[model samples]
Target: MTDQSDKLFTARLADLVSLCERDGTYEFSSFLDERQCADAEQWCKTNTGSLRYRLWGGYENARRRMLAVYPDYCEEYVEGDYPFVCLTFTYRREDKLTHRDFLGTFMGMQLRREVIGDIVVGEGIAQAFVTEVAAKLITTTVSKIGRVGVKITDSKAFELEDAQKFMDISGTVASLRLDCTVGLAAHLSREKAAVLIRSEKVDVNHHTVSSVSHELKEGDVLSVRGCGRFILSGINGSTKKGRIHINLRKYI
Candidate 1:
């Protein structure tokens, strides 16, 4: 059932992309706002499988665009406003990027407003609606303030607790890395890291990594699919390229 839905969404997305490329009838260049969503929804209801329209952008910009397209839709959104909304604005950098690239770039894009959680990667690359994108963006944004895992060599259990408290960890483990720095840091055994790898909990280069010994290189994205992602800065110790050091930011 999931597979069928995925395929359907992909097919629909392809059709939309084709429409954008062929006739520009959907006005891909224009920002889609709340009003646009309402208008689009009405049109979709009547047209059935007609290009599924959605708006994506930062909140205010998206709102403005939507209002311009469908003022009444904005009223509905305003009346029942939730803290989160799914909408994205297409930018010049995103114009030629693929869905995967879009996700990675979105993860790295700057947010000028306060969104309280790390953005989850959009579940469906093909049929990604504004909400899904917003969710991911929010999750990623939250990660900045989140805690990352670090191992301090020779640190006692009590010290570890102190470290965790110092970090102010909450529910989820926001980031993970094999800390090679020489200071009071949390450390994960190769065995534990391997378990994460075997469980399909780790991703490198935007793909799931199953090998625990997957050598951490400089500038690699150590993304633990569902867990979080960290940018691996170069090893900071004694070596030609320095020690194997990883830099992590919490994925919200």
Candidate 2:
């Protein structure tokens, strides 16, 4: 099923590239999940011409991003002009919400995951990016998330902010193995780290990899469920005991 999805995704991207070349105009794709976005980027590098594309999710920094493909002539297009809608969800102050709550509400609508982009949870409010077509459905049907009444509206003047906060930590690992790196960044024992990886609770570059021995390199982003996310910023050098010195930035 995954392979089939990748093939269809690649074909769709190729079609979009062809459309841009043929019409010499801008073409946008439906909101893509993290895996699809990565595939699209790789496809663009080897298959298309100097076709410029922009990845955005109605925010300055987004996790799930969509692609906007255009010719050089369309360089003047702004990020806000992308074919997406930002919906602001407001609930009662007494109802404390979370990212999971907003996402659960959205999923309850039975909308495809591809139709939604990044979801930012704020104090007493949340912002969601969905395909322009899905915006109406969400605003009309999404009234509650587990008893919390939500009022949804189009956020025309919404300002995007950095959705994540980070703290820097430096440590030395015995090796660049996935478990070792995770143990260092998350401050866990080697046994606990291996359990996390083996349980499919870890992701590298947003894709789940269950191999405890998966090699990690610089710039790799690790997302550990319940432990937050981290970026392997650098491998400074080797320690005297043959361990690897590394710098990690943990998202708070």
Candidates in order, TM-scores: namely: 0.34, 0.82
Candidate 1 lDDT over 153-234, as tens digits, reads 1111111111111121111122233222101022454555566677877656545556644555555655554445455543
> What's the lDDT of the predicted structure labeled candidate 1?
0.37
List ranges where model 1 is wrong by over 4 Å: 1-6, 25-186, 213-217, 225-228, 240-243
Candidate 2 Cα errors over 4 Å, as ranges:
163-170, 186-202, 207-215, 224-228, 234-242
Residue-level lDDT tens digits of model 2 in 189-212 = 988999999999999987888999
Local distance difference test scores for all models:
0.37, 0.84
